[model samples]
Target: MAKAYRKDEFEFFQNQVGKIDQRVKSYLEVAGFEKWTWVYAPVNRGRMMTSNLAECINGKLKQARELLIIEFLEEVSASSTHIYSIYDEGKKYIVCLDRSPFSCGRFQLDEITCERAITVLKNKHVVDMKPYCSEYYYPEILRKTYDQSMFPMPYKKEWIVPQEVIDEVVLPPKYKRQPGRPKKNRHKK
Candidate 1:
């Protein structure tokens, strides 16, 4: 019902749900049709349903999540018009050069071509990887980023400060450490 794009389609699903449980149908009705049904939603959610991105990312990070930060970053950080099937040690993988996502998930996460994508590109005789790499890695962008001149700071004694500003008192924040082992990983936003 939430994915139903048309009123009739939504109604069909609603009817089916009603047949299964009248209480659920009543609850859905009380919750407002527009809130849960796509056909009546005022805002366009594109093709992505709620939690779709989160679920997809969670699925992708399943293996990488156990890795160290450096390895995780490396893993997180594809292809052509056709899909390619790749096999490694009896394990089969899929790669598509034209699509943004590969089955490995590295290409999508890092915005860079993964090894599988690279193999496909090599097979296609695509030598230049600049097109596949993120623009942040571009030489022009790098040069532009560091083109501005930087000046060295003067000694503390040579710095000028207002009398009123110097008199201001700033105290450290109060913190109580919680019992248990401290976390090694940085806190995420």
Candidate 2:
């Protein structure tokens, strides 16, 4: 489970962790780990706790700014003595999930375009895009969702697609009109 940080948590942790937050967030951004679909899953070790430990180091350094080199060296040696013990004792794993730094919310797609996107996405093993219409989003699912007569694809296999599908599949949501019953003409004798 992820920990929800209220104002106090963010403030307190940020202050205590100092430069750690900025550094970590910057690193994550550079690594392209800035999407909602991007998850930081380490089987062990909480990064937050690591930041907190680094914070402790920063705190000691803050206090010893005037200390002699010999004294600082001794403190550094002492600090590193049991770093592994601190690491091994953590009871919970910390995983961070970043959602949507790579948004594609307002994108559109058509039948042929969507199939091509799906094929490309399947080829890429994954994709992070939003289909503007439900029809274009899930062609197969939309088929099941609506009557086949209402929404039919022209091509059965190898969805025909040009380079620009998003532009091609742009349509309004309202197409249903109560099936619009056909009228019969009455002739008078």
Best by lDDT: 1
lDDT of 1 by residue, 8-115 (tens): 668899999999999999999999987876567765443222322344455556788899988887766611135667886675667655433455544543456768
Off-target runs (Cα >4 Å) in candidate 2 are 1-35, 38-56, 85-189
Strongest candidate by TM-score? 1
lDDT of 2 by residue, 39-155 (tens): 222331221212244554555466565789998878777655323211113422111111111111111111122232344445546554443123444667766767655656777
* Global lDDT of each candidate: 0.68, 0.39
TM-score of 1: 0.41
For model 1, how big is the CA root-mean-square deviation? Answer: 19.1
Backbone Cα, N, C clashes tallied per candidate: 5, 5
What is the TM-score (0 to 1) of candidate 2? 0.20
What lDDT would candidate 2 get against the real structure? 0.39
Q: How do the predictions measure up, each by TM-score?
A: 0.41, 0.20
Clashing residue pairs for model 1: 77-110, 79-97, 79-98, 80-97, 80-98
